[model samples]
Target: MKLVKVLCALVLVLMLGQQTVFAAAPAPTPAKANEHSSTMKVTFYSDSLHKEMQLNVYLPPNYDAQEKYPVLYVLHSYKLNEDHWFDTLKMKEQADALIASKKITPMIIVAPRIENSFGVNSSKELGYEEGSGNPGDPGVLNKGMYEDYITKDVITYIDTHFKTIQSRNSRYIGGTSMGGFAALHIGLSNPLLFSKVGGHAPALFVGDMWAPLKNLVYPTDEIRKHNDPLLLAASQKLNKQSIYLDCGDQDDFIAATKQLDKVLKMKKTKSYEFHVIEGGHHDDAYWSSQMENYLMFYGATDHH
Candidate 1:
């Protein structure tokens, strides 16, 4: 009987040990699935154009109606619609992951269609007139009222509808290629509106419009000098504002970006970040991979 009781006690000890081990095995890391369901198509009338523009808004997971989120305005490259930024760049998935991992704070992303205007503001309609002007010139279509669409119309619509933190520090703008150029131009021109700016493989320093077209209404040297980002940064008080610039090392515009970096440094702009990744002029893959880093930088600090 004594031997049997001792054996039973030993068995109980072993069973408890097994239970402890199972408990300590660490819960399986939750599956990293893309489970974003909050999405909507928002339409707002543009008072500037007296027309309606469509935009897609992506809200964070478990979003609460009482909470206000920072706004990220993403502009697309030429020939690409507003959906291109989210679909091609895979931004929705990336944003979900970053928010889940706490790498970046939850924010509202607004993407609007510029309709191939290249984010410019012009008085005439897009595209060239047949013999009346330079009919098939690629530069003619790039000149339009896209800048106003982004800065005035789209922004106004977002502010009036969404529960966004309406302040420069809570707003960020990002884009790629031609859209990248627009981001830089608009961000610098209206510093009171956006406190953060980023560009991927941006077409910076595109020289004068004359180089791209013969009859283009190029800005005068004085106006061009005022609008130049590198030049503008020198005089502007970019307090609490940040800039991120990235481009592929093998990109054709790498040299231009490098020049911009040099100018930033010369002006002692300490708030700027520049990166040259190893790759070519690739598309979504490149932007998707770098999106997290840029978004984190944009939302890292609580300027409010």
Candidate 2:
């Protein structure tokens, strides 16, 4: 069944003539009075894609040229670009508050523009256009190469170009919805890269679209195996890394989150945290409410 779905997706990509699509520009909104971070949009060459990719960097207030700080790689949801969180969610304000209160240590936040590839890259057989409307091929482009970009290109560029703590224990990665899935996959697979991980309303089940599209696809052993984070978490014993997983009770992914929690308990993973909030699958408002909690767990407050 999973193979069939992959085949269908391949056909669709072929018929669609893979191309990039950009989202509509967000409405101009004034930054909050208290928000004082500086942002710069820069482009870098992605060796995996063999093209220049744009990314936004947010530097905290009072940034010093001589002092190095931790880095947080923030990924956005499906159909959204790097500006999704900053423009719509006011992540800068949240970060500012946390920094002012000394809850989360001041750090640089990197947001990359993944376009339509669902944070993935494109390849010859599975080309993807950023912001493309097709939801069938999540990682079709770059041949599911989002993980490589984050770990290799993004991390290397930031560490070399900026004053960053260039170590797993001082670096963190996370996102919401589809981005959350990316965070979980990348963090778990490359435990040596990031010491902390966080996900909010992550699209836990990806390869198996049955839960979302009944007529689209059916579940198979392979599909189930690929889409299960619980299985992924159970297979790895990341004793040094800390994980933060949370979902609103009313979220559509709540059941899957609960199942993952059960699996973590069974595995006796000591460095895991789960939270069930009283909310629904809403917008950045929901995520903003929980931002502080994630920051705290990431040890952004720890001076050591």
Candidate 3:
């Protein structure tokens, strides 16, 4: 009977020791799927656009759902889809490498398929656009309320769905070509929406090359001025916003972009960087080549 009691006591002690060991083990970290970073194509409804809009979202490496992350909204060029950044620009690989090297802080990137609205809240013409029935049929081509679509619906969706920092200081906006034009316009006009605005080969409407496009998008001078980044930068006090502009020296939009650089400098618009890449043109080649610079501007260090 004494021996049996000793064995029971021994078992109890062993059980307690095992429990302690188990308790000491660390709990699994969250967001294991984001260990290497990932991107997903999301098709969501937009009240502003009044149609199903497509977006490409990139979650950075080791993205913890429990942790809030800065958001970078990178718009695509006209006629381009949200996947342009991740697929064509190789943003994923570049971002991955950059984060791995600690060259920039990890961030959540939101790229949306912004149709040809010139990034303005204008008229919604019905034509053959995505989410419209029949590909060859004339569907909703340009949903005019792009400004509302992005600012209201898209931002809200991202904020609610993702673990976003959800602060103006933590937000950034950027684009290429026509998208560049839109990014600058949207970022500068909103002022408080984003901490940084980047435009790669933006169409500032000064040069003859962009004049026609500008005329087509902006119905009146008042509307044009409201959406024009150059005018906004010159007039509005964008707080301490950081503006980034880059274009290939050979690109046609170089002149107007340079003019913007000058205006920003003259205004002493807090902080800004303008670069003219040699042999760079207003194409994916130029934009993709400078992905490093772009990422650095948006996520380099922990500005937030």
Q: Which candidate wins on lDDT?
A: 3
Candidate 2 lDDT, tens digit per residue, 175-226? Answer: 8887887787677667788888877778775333533221111124543333
- Which segments of model 3 are wrong by more than 4 Å? 1-33, 124-143, 207-212, 302-304
Candidate 3 lDDT tens digits, 228-296:
778888887865798899999999888889888888887756578889899998888888899999999
- What are the TM-scores, per candidate, against the unseen true structure? 0.77, 0.75, 0.85
Model 1 clash tally, residue pairs: 1
lDDT of 1 by residue, 194-245 (tens): 9888877886665534344312223565645544555656666666568888
Model 3 residue 22 lDDT?
100
Which of the numbered candidates is closest to the native, going by highest TM-score? 3
State candidate 2's TM-score: 0.75
Higher-lDDT candidate of 1 and 2 = 1
